[model samples]
Target: MQTQKIDFAAVQQAFLAAGFDLVGVTDCSPLTGARLARWLARGYAADMEWIGRSFRSRVDPRRLLPGCRSIVVAAAAYEPGRPPTDSSPGKYAVIASYALGPDYHRILRRRCREAVTQLQRTSGQPQKFRIAVDSGPVLEQEIAVRVGLGVIGRNSLLLTPSFGSYVLLAEVLMDTWVKTPEQKPPSRHICLDCRKCVQACPTHALTEEGLVDSRRCISYLTIEHRGPIPEPLRPLLGTHVFGCDICQEVCPANRVRSAPRAPFLPGSPAESRYPSFQELLRMSPEEFKEKFRGTPVARTGYQRFMRNVCVAAGNSGDRSLKPLLESLLSRRGDDPLIREHAEWALEILG
Candidate 1:
């Protein structure tokens, strides 16, 4: 029987139809698993032990789905906007642009599944496939580079000429192989000359080798790192309560002219831009859930989030919020971390 050929154009259309902004295909191959294992062994992954635990599966796509042959990599661009940084020392907070919307995991999974369904039916290929966004043990950036999508930037983010690093990457592993377009070798170190991202890191979290030390990354500190932020790093966090975007903002490559609206962040930009310190300090767990429901902010929960708020309050130099911070410090049953940070904020205000 003559084998029917896969039309790559049709596949591209399928992905675009499903709303993916960027798409590419590559052979399923072993990524830098050994290097990742070494990094994990060195404890660079910080408290994210899950990355080490899933090391084997993340390195080899075949382990994820037996007989996996080709990887269909996709990128969904998130709109880039400068987070409001208040130099006025007022009560303001900054949040990562990605988290200012619905969780990318849910959005990308739904969108990728829709695209995969279209690919199967339209291309007349085997339906055996697996979808993964950030949740899965997949080296999405590596796959993306293999497929000629982009190169790893100095900030350790996949950088595309068109989208820069403001994209959420996802992948679909399939059992069937498809002929992908030829491309030049990926420029892994795209920012060799430019060190803006490195210089912009307030905490020097980025290394000279272009890797992130999550221990000092404000994004990691504010979001992933639980408990009272180390006193030394508290002032460095500035007014960022959730995540930091200073590195991206300083990257010349990220100065893209414009971008289409990110589908996940549906509300008015102001609505999710920055949470006021007063509001966050007083927000109950249920209130936090209701206000940030389906958004990444909810993942931090009230206590940890308030912990971040206290740090931002301390950095804000906004004496007006002292009463609110004082209330939190006196409130019984408050997490000690929150109380500790509140006390620090009081000291800063004084």
Candidate 2:
């Protein structure tokens, strides 16, 4: 006996049941690889060499999974709570909303897997599918746009009409075709004349020309860059210890949305939500893992996180951090990344 055909309504229901905030589908089509090639050629991707190497796979989902016919795109809303404030005795560190909880890579993967399973079981024959999260070279935002999720804001993030720019994206590539949903106008194609995200970037990473120089992006420096942040951009980092949200924070489309009541995101422990610079500076490698194991903070590990904490301390302008910064500076350590940032913090404080 042949199995029943997969129902689009059932697949959509499965995604929603799996905690996805929005879901859309599109047939596989060629993406704008030439534009991406131009971006990479300009070195806008910074030190992320994988982007250049994986350009073909990123632009064409076919490179990721052979015989892929359709893509199911999902978006999970992450709450962008109040911005981090430095009104405390010392500096209060800022982490992006996406990194506050358990890493969404795992969450999205597991959920997408279950979603695919839910989908396959209903199909006429066994189905083949592959999961793609942020780490995947697939052009998720572009897929999201094609699938009618949202537009890409000036910050280079997907801005959903309901969730703003605070949504995490995931995709499932299937060997079989699914009915395509009606797509909204591409975000970049329909972007208004307003340049709020461009203007709000502290380091001018987001340019008036709608280009992002990732080397100067605070989020990239804090999380991805392993070396010492350049001295010139240190002050521009502000108190953001993990990731920067300035561009999204200033977006007008993000303001008028009816925010998700309970964001489809898990919450972090209270301590991790608002960590102290002194405590972070004192944390050992093991302790750092213990505190941030499943979250995105672990991606930076102890050395880089502490390195960022030192920068935040210096930028805090709070003389109280002097003793702690001194301790890091005076310690017998050859890790110049940490020591140099500590020295810069001291210089800033003095």
Candidate 3:
């Protein structure tokens, strides 16, 4: 007689039991395989080429964690108790909603680990198990989409019906061959005829098809890319000093959704929602690091981050900022990219 199979429901139940608002599982094969190939073929990932490089491990969860037979996808809502109000003018340092609270990677990974532990308690330990929260070689959104957690938005964000795009994607790869639930497909989005995102992008980064050209993406220039930001793009960057949500901001889908206070996220800002640019320009690297230690702004580093601050200052034309911009204008940064941007900011302010 064959040994009895462990219940897949027990594993699914474990994640929900452990506080994951969303959880679903999928067989470790083809659907994931094909999507990975498609994303790589388009070459839309830009400098994040690593995404394409880790193809096999991303598709075959078992390659990364041997004996893995089932993959679990989980999401946690973080809709912000109250999102940033409409106006925080003068080059505000707007952070992406996902980064405001404690790092979601840590939060989600711990939750996934807990769920795995609970699964182990009930489903029995096996050869191996692992969890990835945008931390490793998994195609998170693609997996989420294939696993039936959410629909892939034209913007490339995973949009869940109940939560919209405010949820973070996280996953678990386990050794046992647990059964998976068929994922419900995402609903048709309202972005059908509206080209709001493409039309609204200051730099035209959002291609007509919704694929963002990273070189033109303000968020990529200010946050992801190293060295100075491109000059022509400076003025168009607007006031966003860290991450930008312009596309989401203009998106009708994002406008009237009923998500939670985004409790999984930080509460409303005590004093202010968006960070003031002038304060950022003057902050020492050490000071900046401490302030945003794990926050999204910290990802940009000191010098590059300040370069953005300076640009925002120049654009504000507050007159009070002349002394500050003058200070940055004097010191030539080591990187031409940074210097090129500073020079452009001065031109804009002039």
Name the candidate that leads on TM-score: 1
Report the lDDT of model 3 for residue 73.
Answer: 86
By descending lDDT, how would the candidates be arranged?
1, 2, 3
Q: Is candidate 2 or candidate 3 better by lDDT?
A: 2
- TM-scores vs. true structure, each candidate: 0.92, 0.91, 0.87
Clashing pairs in 2: none
Model 1, stretches more than 4 Å misplaced? Answer: 1-5, 34-38, 82-90, 187-189
User: Model 2 segments beyond 4 Å from truth?
Assistant: 1-5, 83-90, 124-126, 182-184, 187-191, 259-271, 330-332
What lDDT does the true structure give each of the candidates?
0.79, 0.77, 0.69
Give per-model CA RMSD. 2.3, 2.7, 3.0
Q: Candidate 3: list runs displaced more than 4 Å.
A: 1-8, 32-43, 80-88, 258-262, 270-273, 328-340
lDDT of 3 by residue, 1-350 (tens): 34334566787677777667777777677344564565456765657787777887776676888766777888877664344465546646556656666777777778888887876676575447788887799877777777677676666667777777777777887766665555676666646777877888888877655466777887788788776666667778877676677787676667666555225566747223476667766666678788878766676777787777777776676666666666655654555654666666677777
User: Residue by residue across 120-239, what tens digits does model 1's lDDT show?
Assistant: 777767458898988799988777877777887778888887788888888888887777778557766668789898988989998766578888889888889986688998899998
Cα error, residue 346 of model 3, in Å, equals 2.3
User: Which candidate would rank higher by lDDT, 1 or 3?
Assistant: 1
- In model 2, the Cα lDDT at residue 283 comes to 71
Report the Cα lDDT for residue 133, model 2. Answer: 87
Q: Flag the better candidate by TM-score, 1 or 2.
A: 1
- Candidate 2, residue 249: the lDDT equals 77
